[model samples]
Target: MLPFERIITIDRESKVPIYRQIAIAFINAISQGIIKANTHLPSTRDLSKLLEVHRKTIVAAYDELEAQDWVVSVPRKYVAVSAKIPNLKPKKWMDEVNESAYRALFQLPFKQIVVPKVKSNAQLPEVIIDDGFPDVRLSPIDDLLKIYRSYTSKKHSIRNATFGSAQGSLKLREVLASYLSETRGLNIEKEHLLITHGAQMSIYLAAQLLLAKGDVVVVGKPNYSKATQVFEQTGATVVEVGVDKSGLLVEEIQAICQQKAIKAIYVIPHHHYPTTVTMSIERRIALLKLSQQYAFAIIEDDYDYDYHYASSPYLPLASSPHQGNIIYIGSFSKLLDPSIRIGFMVAPFNFIEQGVALRKLIDVGVDGYMQNALAELIRMGELKRHIKKAKKCYFSRRDYLDHLLQEHLKSQVSYSLPSGGMAIWIVLKKEGLVEYLVQHPQLAIRRSAIELNAFRFGFASMNETELEQAVLLLKKIIEGFELQGVKGQL
Candidate 1:
């Protein structure tokens, strides 16, 4: 007998149709090489008897597989595996036919736009380094579990059980408004808030609401890649403003605005993405002044303002008014958990009605129960305690990363010690440095090139011990790069 593994397991209670499930099992078997190419499969009658299903059901399953080109029927014996299967390459004549079909469908006469294929999440290599995610290992999960159980045990609030209002739960908004006023000095009412899926969605929605095709928007050089993509997708022309230690160059922004067609300025003033440099108060004032004179809006993305390791956090530009020119965006993802997916935009009161309307069309609203739960957390001062604890944790991690980098990779790379934020942007001493680092067997996936030599290291996720190991590995990779003498321009 052939070494074919049994692939089908019928789940009578499953919502999936039986025939479809059977077809999937067969395809899985074929892909796994359990059922070899050109091998004979048992007849429908035999399979029906083995599976305790009607003969018609087995026939239906086989017919479905045949329709998908997974198998071919032979006369009076058994079904032979087909030369072609969907998404499977069978090193045979079928490859030529499939290649021709694919070319006909995807190839164009003109110069084709090369779109990078999106890697599935499952295909992405797991990051064993401490820098890949936030440090959730130390989270007070026991406390949270207790809170969750207590909250869920109560009678389900009908308001929270259904899709929430587009404005988010009023209680959450009210709590947030007070928190912002007290913490960040931004005095805002609940009516001006529109909860979103996350900071990215808020940015995307704001771009959609404010920008038109071919409109000009100034973005900081080496900014958030995801934000850049969102603006590009909206058909806006993104002009990059250079940054020094003080943050974005105000003169470059003024020069762009002078062109008289710019729509908005996107910035992360508290701690800029990748670079982790905070904009000075003078620069913030200049930016706000430019927005007033130039007739464009400012998208103030206050992404990591909640956790300041330094003396105190800087107040957001939105807190100081330039008369409805600022659209302030904030998120709880970093403070709580990324999975929470809760963010809010504080717009001018005049724009709130339309903004909420747009939000309704997007996701209907943020998760109602989560919103209510967060509201309760805020009301009970649990969120405040969480933020305080998170700040201390992040501060320790940031300091440890800085110390390790300086101690290990000092001569090869340089980065500023940021006061706050989850990441540090390292500028390599030589161009094409990341490509060399990633070639190491240990770091073949984790290290990625942002532009050329510049890369981001998110240190908030790892503990001091893990960070030490990572730094040692990174140093070894850099030493190898130097030995190779691989020279390229940044």
Candidate 2:
């Protein structure tokens, strides 16, 4: 056992709140590495007695530390060291003001910027089939709370609360290094992982890191809309490449790169967003080759690898040998709950340091306690078990939705049965189906789609019963469209 140093020193005369002083001291110790990772410290009672302070005071101090992600707490037992010292700083006032100005100007009511009205109801439906949100009903809340409680009872050192190193928690990186290597066959070290808020943030960071204004990036047509928006926000010219049953047409991507100076290609190969079509292994290899030949990067958005229902799920595009040009993005949002907000980017070892630096500038580090808890979850094999349970649940829902679609709206609408992922993209026989449905007397909510003819339905969020009702309602809407006899434009 490591020697327990006197971690708490209180000055009653100091003007600073006891809690704030305690938080500062804890951060200092963590920075010096005096308190190591996973090291369980004395209980709050023991620490209060040792420091001759009231237990309540220590509790308050510890609460501050926990909020900052410096320590982890367990009920009535002990607290544990969860993260290392973070190296972060507050943004300059000028930068903040400048950003605020830009947003204000951009958000000024403009014709091109279509802002949707907020929903009036405070309570959303329990089963939301239209929104592409992962089902969080089956998350391991008990285990998470247990872990959270375990880490919060100790006295945090000064080092632990300070800004962390940009790469994120070392323990998280270490665990993800092994997890990705084993599960996805991607060879990466702790140094190669840069943790972010989620895959969306990963996309934004990759754009910030790799792209400059006026750069060209090839994206799949009818791609993840948010990704396209991110690229556009970065002032990059987005060129859409058509996707077939196999995947993005590699030859078309090649032709685009040949014709223009392409910076990167953003794609979801394992299960494409909205439309869950796995890119073929041959196409994956071809994409890597194209990137190698064209001297561009491939941003592989491997969003839903955990719940694959196909006989053989498509391998990640980054799994193959390439010239260190693949920026592979993964997230825990789909596997676990979106509230977890932990995702990672796997890049070449050389890019790790710079990426971490950029990440620090972006969000400092992600919540340290969550990262530590996730590390513990991964270490104890709880994560895999949760994923297994989720896969079964989602697959059942997928089947239920498919059955409902076939039974009701068979010939009027067409959809590809997805092997995995949270949502299915559907194409209606008539254009403007979404408009027509929203305008229906019964339903008043409007939605946006990539095309007037296409819309996505997420099966994961709804249970069998809720799904049955939603499909029945949707079928009625489709039938109405058929009755109208809308023809394609000449």
Question: TM-scores, in order shown?
Answer: 0.76, 0.72
Candidate 1, backbone clash total:
0
- Clash counts per candidate, in order, are 0, 28
Candidate 2 per-residue C-alpha lDDT over 29-98 given as tens digits, one digit per residue, 9 for 90 to 100:
6545655566786777877777677789878877887888888888777777775645434332223221
Mark the regions of model 2 whose C-alpha exceeds 4 Å error after superposition. 1-127, 155-163, 438-452, 479-490
TM accuracy, model 1:
0.76
Global CA lDDT of candidate 2, please? 0.75
Which lDDT tens digits does candidate 1 get at residues 1-490?
4422245667789897877777777776677555667778878887788778888888898889888888998767788788664344433322222122344665557744346453234343323442224566655445655665565666665445354688788778888899888998887899888888888888988888888889988899877777888888788898999988899999989887776677999999998876789999999999999888888999999987876778799999999977887899998877766776889999977676777877777577456667777777787888788778877888888888888887888888987888788888788887778766554456533334546576668787777887787788788777777767745333
- Per lDDT, the best of the predicted structures is 1
User: Can you tell me which runs of candidate 1 are displaced by over 4 Å?
Assistant: 1-133, 156-158, 439-441, 444-452, 486-490
